[model samples]
Target: MKPQRRLRLGMVGGGEGAFIGAVHRLAARMDDRYELVAGAFSSSLENCQRTGAALWLDPARCYASYQKMAAQEADGIDVVAIVTPNFLHAPVATAFLQAGIHVICDKPLCLNAQQASQLAAVVKQSQCQFILTHNYSAYPLIREARQRVLSGELGEIRFVEVEYLQDWMSELVEQTDNKQASWRGEPAKAGAGCIGDVGTHAWQLASFVSGMLPQSLSAELATVVAGRALDDDVRVTLRYANGARGRLWASQVASGHENSLRLRIYGSEASLEFQQENPNQLWIRPRNAPAYCLTRGSGVLSDEVRTMGRVPAGHPEGYLEGFGQIYREAADQIWAAIDGQPFSGSLLPGIDDGVAGMKFIDAVRHSSMADGKWVDFSAA
Candidate 1:
């Protein structure tokens, strides 16, 4: 296949001081797969201008709202990266998808399942590529874990445990003009707060590695912080249709923990573990055997996992590189779409994944409200 021109990418959010916005930008540019051409960086025009100027975007292309950006760039931009708050995700993604532009949006899909369903419809009707930025799924070791699990290296998966913990919201940071925390803590703006934020990532990571979806769930969602509206902590049990069980625990008030996302999957024959903080190494333990560490960029890595690593073994490739992998995969799909060719083997999360995430979130909330009843996950 002939190499296509670099993808023309636009942004709907990620203005100044928004952590994930900068992350999306860096990820998009990391592999040279995309060029940021346009953006409505923030709701405030002044902030948008500042962000546009900082990103070296043409002033005329940075609009005041996502609607204008979508309408005006419909013919020019090939992809729109939606990095706004959770509530804006559905609307912004819908507009871009309707405009026939592919989308690379931040995760948790939308504010709720209804919005997720609506956005899923838009994506289906438009037939546009929609890539949800579940960056953790892009890690090379995580890909290795998925491949190993699929190849039966770990035998029958019996138990899975995943946790994502952070201490940023342990205190009432939302009350101190912390823009990220402010919107994130608000139910209207962030949907389910910690659950929607990092919890969704945990959910996606678990499903991605184990290749199993929860059939039923019992959840306890709590607001650890006194003044917080939405959940700051969550603990959920997952029952898989295949009789495999799992547990997920996510918290923003886990004091002293910062970005401590970890996954442990145990099978009848073996087990595998991976941690986000030490992303370069994956642990594998066979039945009655000592644990062994597998490092990235090693010759032992499978071809698929090897391709995801940019540097050699000792040099670390963490969050940004993992994020870039997702962008590269999305770029491949986008080019395939443009060239009218068959697209295959893409691991990037799409609209269906987004909807499922919303449903998982809804199930958690409902189960919590119902006193931790075993809620049917399919019904979510």
Candidate 2:
């Protein structure tokens, strides 16, 4: 194989004090397949300049707006990672895709399904890869679980239960000086609050692991925080195509919890359980048999999982490692497309995953407003 060229990456949003922007940079650098060449670090010009200088980025490559950055970096940047707030995702992504750059975007693709559809059209027209960072799907054990279900070891999955809960905003943290909680609690910046933020992760993980799309859903949303415009908690019940039933709950106001993402899948012959806090191991129980614990680097793991697993069985790899896998796989696809070569392996989450997530969010929002009635997600 010829030596792969490093992709020149431009970032939109993710300035000082932003959570996910730095995470994207770290993930991209992990595989050494991409370089951060340019960025519009923040919405404000001064912040963008300060952030650029802090990162040792060239002044010429940093811009005040994504529109200017996209036009200027079109010939240089191979990919653009959009890490801005939810409302900016569609516009920034549209700008880059229109300029012929592949996009690796954060989840909850856009503010609405219509915006997601517009972005999808651009992606199709450009024929460029659009990777959605559903980072949970990159976990080695999660990959193993997916393969097990596909291989019929689980024997027809029938139910899925996914929950992503956090206690950060439980008690009106947004009223204080917490930067993360402030904008996230605002309806304009964060989109649909908990449903658009963490709920999308739970929804994506359930579908990614189960290989099923939600057909319809019933949902309820709550604003536990006083004076908050958007929901801080969400509960959704999902109906899948193959008669599978699933439930998802995401809350920033769940007391005593912090980034606790859990998934349980039950089938006719077996069941599997995986948790984000304990990412290295997966619990598997076959019908009428003893329960088994599968670790990331163990002999019981699949080739795909093993290849992605970086450490030994006793050692641990968590968020950073899983995030790195997503970036590496994305880089593989981007580089393949750039070099006019075929991609090597599957990367589960893509533009379609983004569309599905946006549809899920919109459907749940509609369902909540409709007195928790079932809403057809297909219409999204």
Candidate 3:
């Protein structure tokens, strides 16, 4: 198939001071698969205009609200990236999808199951693709780990552990001028603090690599920071359908840690570990053999997996590159669907993955509220 032009992109939120929005912009452009064309960058018109001017976007294309952007740019851009707060995720996505635009949304899907149901319905009725940015799963070694497990290298899975820790909110940062912290520390905006923020990422990573969603879970959710309105620390025990058990921990108040997302999977025959801070290596411990490390650039990776990186091994691609892989995959999938051609298969996260994350979150919240009782995933 002949190569096509870059997908024209638009964004909502991530205006002047947002962090993740800039990350999304960098990642989307890293693989040269997308070109941002417009955005409703902020609720404030001045901020939107300033952001658009900085990006060299047409001043007219920078709308004051997402609803206006969705209406006017509906046919102008190929896809819209949703980088708004958690509470706005569902509605923003719904508007774009209803306008027949594809979407690349940030994680935790939405605030709760009710929003999930509404967005799920919109996704089903739309013809456009939906890509959720579970960027961790798109890492090179992480993809290899998923392949290895799916190919039976792990035997029957027995244990899974995922812990995502950060210390950015160790104090009452929300009480200050921290823009990200202000909304994130609120239940209305962030939904569930560390659980919705990082716990879902951990859960998604476990399920992505291990290919197992728990049957039920017992959880303890706590607001580790004093005077905080939302839970910042969480521990959950997972029970898989095959009797395999798992543990997940996410905390924004974990001191001396920054983006310390890590995972370990133990099966009948061996165990594997991956740490985000390292990003370039995976450690495998076999039952009978000495454990060894798997690096990102190793020849062990398939041709397809290696394409995720812009440079060769030892160049050290981390968070940004992992996120770029998602954008690249979304571009490929969307182009394939448009061209009526069979293209490379994808493991891109979609609406179902988003819904699963929501349900897991709901169950965890329920279990924690019910005195750490086991809450079935089915009821979520």
Candidate 4:
């Protein structure tokens, strides 16, 4: 097969000081798979023009609105990357997908499950790919963990514990005009603060590792910051189909912690633990044997894990690398779809996962608001 060409991409947001936009660009460029040809960087036209200049995009192609960009870039661009706030994800993605372009969207797919379902329907009708950037699932070690659980290496899973904690919003940073914090704390912009922000990551990671969706969930949400509209901390207890139990805690109010995401799964025969801070190692303990440490590129890794591990042993592959893997896989699928060829491999998280995340978010919020009563996640 001939090598596929780079994708022509456009961005919906991620203007000045935007966090995830630059990361998306870096991940796209890391493997030479996508070229950001245009963008509607911000709501402000001036900021959009400035960002377009900085990105060296053509003036005519730089748009001030996603609707205009989608209509115009439909014939030119191959894909659109939506890096906007939570509320904008569904509209932007729907526009691009309706325009017959592939989409690479950030997580917490939309403001709610209703919008997620609408976008999912569009993705199904359009022949374009919709890749969600739940990048942690692309980590080599994470792939290994998923394989172990799926292959019954850990026997029948009985418990799952996952937590994602950060201290960036420990105080009222939004009151001080912090751009990231300002929009994120606003319910209109971010949808659900830390729960929608990081809790989605926790939920996705757990489901990714276990290959099981929660049947029901009971949750508690708290806004520690005075006058904040959304929850800054969330605790959820999940019930799985096979009678397995899980607990998830996601918080931005954990003082002194910075992006601390950890997961542990226990089964009848063995257990596994993975820490995001230490991405390269996986701890495994058998019921009657000594605990073992497995590194990313070790001999114990499966073929699937080794395929995702690009660098040699001892080399650290962090967030950007994992994100890059997702982009690479998406690029492959996009190219295959474009060329009408077979692409016979998984492409990390996609639109289905996005729908699942949004449903999970809705269930969490409903469960919390109902005084921690069990809410059926599958109903969403």
Candidate 2 residue pairs in backbone clash: none
lDDT of 3 by residue, 35-67 (tens): 999999999999999999999999999999899
Please give the CA lDDT of all the candidate structures.
Answer: 0.91, 0.87, 0.91, 0.89
Ranking by TM-score: 1, 3, 4, 2
**Candidates 2 and 4: which is better by TM-score?**
4
Between which residue pairs do clashes occur in model 4? none
What TM-score do all the candidates reach, one by one? 0.98, 0.96, 0.98, 0.97
At residue 357, give the lDDT of candidate 4: 89
Tens digits of per-residue lDDT for model 1 on 10-114? Answer: 998888888888988888898888999999988899999999998888999999888998899999899999888888888888888899999999888898898
* Model 2 regions lying over 4 Å from their true place: 2-4
lDDT of 2 by residue, 1-380 (tens): 54457889889989988888999999889878788989998878889988899989998888998999888888989999999878888888888999999999988898888888888999999898899888889999989988888888989889999999998887877778888787776777778888888999999888888888888899999988788888989999989898999999999988999999999999999999999999998999999899999987689787767889777677878898878898888877877898898886676588888888888888988999999999988995
TM-score of 2: 0.96
Residue 321 lDDT in model 4?
Answer: 92
Higher lDDT: candidate 3 or 4? 3
lDDT of 3: 0.91
In candidate 4 the C-alpha lDDT for residue 76 amounts to 89
